[model samples]
Target: MSKAYNETVALSQSGALAALRAAVEKAQEMGVPQCIFIVDPSGETIASLRMDGAKYLSMHTARAKARTAASIRNATGSMTPEFAVAAGIASNGGVTNLPGGLPIRFGGKLAGAIGVGSGTGDQDIEVGRAALAAIEADPI
Candidate 1:
């Protein structure tokens, strides 16, 4: 039998919150507060947290990173300099090449993405990874 619609896996609110909490915990462990954002496969926000002392402006980048990862089904920061610039401009800053974004997959299905900011790119990635681990999702 063939169906026109395919079953879709989505990120639950609880999963999103768990990821956010785990990301915050990791940020605390690293002594760097951060803005963490989680988005669904369609780039809809699920949960987010801006820890105390985290850069408020960085929240925007975090959102962009999350949306970009979910939209592209790939981790951020892989884009080259030229593509990064072009994509950022083309998307009007909706997408970014920042290193903090990671796609989340569950049961071999794309679930969503997470983005961490207000720290060094490596640190951000570390926090994002912690979030992914918390949800038992496949690492990006």
Candidate 2:
């Protein structure tokens, strides 16, 4: 049977919040505050949180990271320097090559994306890993 479309799992608001909570917990454990952002499969913001002491502007990057991950359906920050800059410029900063962005995959489907910021890139990625773990998301 040929189908016109395929139904897929989508990330809900509760899942987004759970990811945000896990990211926050990881940041706290690492002694760094963070701005955690989660976006739906279509790259719309679903939930977010900025821990105290996190850099305020990091929220912007967090959004960018989330959008980028959702858009590409993969982790952010693998782009080369030139492409990263060009993509940023072309997308008008809608996407970014930040290391903290990871696609939230579930049941072999793309569910959503999470973005973390306000710490070192390594720390941000670490926090994001914790989030994915909390949700039992498939690895990217």
Q: For model 2, which pairs clash?
A: none
Model 2 worst lDDT run, 10 consecutive residues: 1-10
Expressed as tens digits, the lDDT of each residue in 3-117 for candidate 2 is: 4222247887778788888888889999999998898888888998999999999999999999899888889989999999999999899889989999988876778789999
The TM-score of predicted model 2 comes to 0.92
Lowest lDDT sum, 10 consecutive residues, model 1, at 1-10
Q: Which residue runs of candidate 2 sit more than 4 Å off their true CA positions?
A: 1-8
lDDT of candidate 1 over 3-121, digit per residue (tens): 42222478888888889889999999999999999998888998988999999999999999999998878899998999899999999999999999998888667788898899999
Give me the overall lDDT of model 1.
Answer: 0.90
lDDT, model 1, position 16: 88
